[model samples]
Target: MHPITTVHYLALSAALLLIGTVGVLTRRNIVIILMSIELILNAVNINLITFSRIWHNMDGQIFAIFVITDAVAEAAVGLGILIALFRNKETVLADEIDLLKW
Candidate 1:
């Protein structure tokens, strides 16, 4: 049996990021896209914490904390925007949004 290593953690993070990327690209719903973005951010946090553990340093963890804070703010703003858009447009489809189109 092989022992798990940092490589394993990194691979998992990569997979998560890939899934998130696909979701963001292929999903038409705005809320799902926002969730996918959060997933990508979580993958980043996983990598940061994993590297911090391997390096025996606090920097990665600190960065992860910052990332979490940013994610929270992003979620709040994203949901707020989503609500506003829904109220004005009555739909969540990305293609249906044209408020900024020229």
Candidate 2:
């Protein structure tokens, strides 16, 4: 069997990102959208680690760590908003949470 290559990793990452983007765009549920966002971030992390391995450098790994940290923070804040919206509107659907409407 041929060994895995950077191209293989890149292809997987691209697929993941496409899935995540589609989910975010097509889903009506806020939670699903948030999960999709995380999926996108994870795809990015995979790319970072893949390049790090290919280049034999630590920078990509370090950048992946930062991306992970940002993902965590985003999840926390997003869930908090979701919870608050649920309490007020009792629905997780993005279209129904319209708090900005007059």
Candidate 2 per-residue C-alpha lDDT over 1-102 given as tens digits, one digit per residue, 9 for 90 to 100: 999888999999999999999999999999899999999999999999999998899999999999999999999999998898788789988888666887
lDDT of each: 0.95, 0.94
Query: Over the full model, what C-alpha lDDT does candidate 1 score relative to the true structure?
Result: 0.95
Question: Where does the lowest 10-residue lDDT sum fall in candidate 1?
Answer: 93-102
Instruction: List runs of model 1 lying over 4 Å from the truth.
Output: 99-102
> Candidate 1, TM-score vs. the true structure?
0.94
Best by lDDT: 1
lDDT of 1 by residue, 1-102 (tens): 999999999999999999999999999999999999999999999999999999999999999999999999999999999899789889999988876866
Tell me the TM-score of model 2. 0.93
Q: What is the lDDT of candidate 2?
A: 0.94
